[model samples]
Target: MFNERIHRLLKEISEAFADRRDPFNNEWLSKNDVSIDELHQLTGAVSSILDGFLAAPKETQVLLLSVGMAASSFRG
Candidate 1:
């Protein structure tokens, strides 16, 4: 489940990069000379860190999920 969550985040990041006209798209990253592979590398690091966060208390887990959802909504 944790890995899935990380994958979902990475997917969102990819979609954001692939689309430019979309309101929630990451135009800033695209405009600033960011690459899709760079985003993947960044998320890879994040996933590693989040792996430990996943082992925390239930409250922390809920917080992580909430943050993830918020980010998704922002992406949309």
Candidate 2:
């Protein structure tokens, strides 16, 4: 279930990035200058990480989410 959800989220993010007419999208891509292939590779990496998490036990899954939350908070 988590794997599927993460895949969907990555797909949504990819679609948002690919749609060039979006103002924020344009500015973001312009600033970052990521190639299409690089973005595809990143999406693949995200899927692999999600797969690893899904294979872990339930307790570990919660721990992973907690770590991710902390990391995101730090980024902000």
Choose the strongest candidate by TM-score: 2
Candidate 1 Cα misplacement greater than 4 A, ranges: 1-47
**Per-prediction RMSD in angstroms?**
9.4, 9.4
lDDT per residue (tens digit) for residues 1-76 in model 2:
3455445445445455445334236565455565676556656766787899999999999999898667555643
Q: Which whole-number lDDT from 0 to 100 does residue 70 have in model 1?
A: 82
Cα misplacement distance, residue 44 of candidate 1 (Å): 5.9
Error of 2 at 53 (Å): 1.4
Model 2 earns a TM-score of 0.55
Worst 10 residues of 2 by lDDT: 15-24
